[model samples]
Target: MSAIIRTENLTYTYSPDTPFEKTAVNDVCLEVEDGELVGIIGHTGSGKSTLIQHLNGLIRPTSGRVIIDGQDIWEKGVNLRDIRFKVGIVFQYPEYQIFEETVFKDIAYGPKNMGLDEKQVGERVRETAALIGLDSALLEKSPFELSGGQKRRVAIAGVMAMRPKVLILDEPTAGLDPGGREQVLEEIREYHRRSGSTVLLVSHSMEDVARFATKILVMNHGSVFCYDTPPNVFMRADEIAEMGLSVPQITRVFSLLRKKGIDIRGDVYTVDFALKTINEYIASKGSAREDGHD
Candidate 1:
């Protein structure tokens, strides 16, 4: 329930003082509570990537501060190595980063770098592999031999093996089939539930975020548009669209019904919720008709 990740007036610029200079992230203040799964969404170039880069200590903010686990990451003598270990980032197409011959070794790489012994690394790798739904039989096979989704799970498990306190995933499910996407996201949800570590998922899929995230962080024009629960964020359907991001398709449908003078709740953000709402509405109307007959 405490804040594990906090950014105070965080700002970043590219090509500073040059003709190509531009602010990518500006005065962004944000907080992510420990063990919370947060979905970060925005239009292209809305600073989602840059902002998260700061959290992983991969980029220095032009100004402001990035505080992780109650310590300013940039403060004097604050070790960046330690910060990176605390915040593990799995980038898009992380499969390309895989180099080890075996899936087990790929997953063991991080723990090994952390100076873990052979026995410890093996234990960590197997535990993380199982956590991500990778089979024990597949651990010995080459990472290249796995399916796209399996490769992704292996790469993600590689990061998880380090036992980071905060995990940041950038476009984690990108390019996967719908089934693959669902499997990966569900595994991520399970990982968060079992590990009790905070997760920041940077994704463009409104439905994915709506389905899995405890809270949503909407970014716009390099600023914090809003940070709230799924229902609260999706309720601003029109405003979100105006920012070049669509609400979940179901949310849009409910919004359209409201605009057409139908009495419908505007907070529908998932297919399952939409179905429930529709059934409830029909039942209510039926009840009214029965009352009239009585």
Candidate 2:
């Protein structure tokens, strides 16, 4: 399958030629396949935010290229507005981006910008709102009047209304209670399931990524550290820790178990996988003992 998004030697520098000049992203090359749920994790200042902004043309690279559908997004005459429509991004605290008075208008912002008519825009708004569990009645109320979680839903619905082919979310679950976080993450998961769109989820939580992401991308010091399946990435737990990141909690538990001479896989990143591995190990041990007794 072809890549939906590809970045080649992409680098971005801030305040170039000045004392404040700094490279936020450096020679980062990566590919995200169509219909993938990719999780991006990194330490602070690792360029996760800067890298993602390039995907949607929110920021241009000082060097290198961001290619979408095999076309260079920054090529002369490329319609950047159209590119933004195809690649929707919800930044950290996306709620701050909300400016429309009513929830309906806020959610309709993207569709309207796409030049859809009232009927199409309203339909898209309602559909996306429903997808994010927003009530139709709440659509008429001001977004500021909603609860924190509701505000997040409205913000997410705003992006989903545009129905982008590639949806990028940055820290979608930050500053929320466990219930709120789970709700938002689950809605994102369901959105991916139903839309079949490529998703880039930039999060700090290894457990969340381990549970949802099809693949994990680790960034360190403005470069691509590792891009692989969760299990493969977690297998480098020591390296990840050295870089100031970590694998999931259960993965650490299993790793500890292995150190204690238990015959268990240390690479399990989720509780469910850990349980399955442990149960299988116990069953094998039980069978061996039974055979010896026989």
Candidate 3:
């Protein structure tokens, strides 16, 4: 399938043509395929956010082009508002954006703007709220009256109501408890599965990304550091550490085990994989012990 999003030599400058000018993204090129779940990761000030903004026409590239579904999003006469509908972005702490008196109104805002029929907007609002785990009864209540986690879910439902083809989330679970975080992440995964949309998750947690993303993009100092599957990316533990990043905890544990002379693979990123490998090792050692006695 063709790329849902593609960047060619994408660059962005902050305070351009001024004394305080700085390049936030430099000579970057990448492609995000249709229905792919991708994660963008970086330390602070690595331009991850800036890069994502270009994808949905939120920020026009200072140089080069951003193509969404074979069309240059910045092209003349192209309606950016339409692009936004196609590429939904949920900002960090999206809950803060909620201003409507009721959760239903907040979630319906996007579809309403699209001129959808009232019935369609209501249907979308209810469906999206359910997808994000928002209670049906809460739809009529003021959004500000809800808990922080609940507000976050409402905000996410707001975007999902639009049914965008590409969904981009910037730290969807920031500042939530473990349970809240898991809930939000699970909702996002379920949305992707049901909609078959392209997903771009920007997060700092390697473990979370490893669990959800099919591909990982590591950014450092306004450039692409690496892009690969989680296992392949985490395999370079030393390099990742040098870049002020880290592999998942399970991967790190396996790496430490390898250093201690364990005869097992060190590249395991998921807990399930790590546990399976450990069990196999134990079974093999047990067989060896029996054979030695025989």
lDDT per residue, candidate 3, 1-294, as tens digits? 999999999999999889999899999999889999998999989999999989889898899999999999888999999999999999999998999999999999999999999999999999888888888999999999999999999998999999999999999989999999998899999999999999999998888888989999999999998888877888787688788886788888888888899888766888899999999999999999999999
Candidate 3 is scored at a TM of 0.95
TM-score, every prediction: 0.95, 0.96, 0.95
lDDT of 1 by residue, 160-220 (tens): 9999999999999999999999889999999999998999999998889889999999999
- Model 2: how far is 236 from its true place, Å? 1.3
User: Clashes in model 2: which pairs?
Assistant: none
Candidate 2 residue lDDT tens string, 1-294? 999999999999999999999999999989999999999999889999999999999998999999998889999999999999999999999999989999999999999999999999989999998899998999999999999989989998899899999999999999999999999999999999999999999999888888999999999999999999988998887788788887788888877787799887657888888889989999999999999999
Summing lDDT over every window of 10 consecutive residues in candidate 2, give the lowest-scoring window.
258-267
Winning candidate number (TM-score): 2
- In candidate 1, stretches whose alpha carbon ends up further than 4 angstroms from where it belongs are 286-294
Model 2, residue 42: C-alpha shift (Å): 0.8
Residue 280 displacement in candidate 3 (angstroms): 2.6
Q: Model 3: which ten-residue window has the lowest total lDDT?
A: 237-246
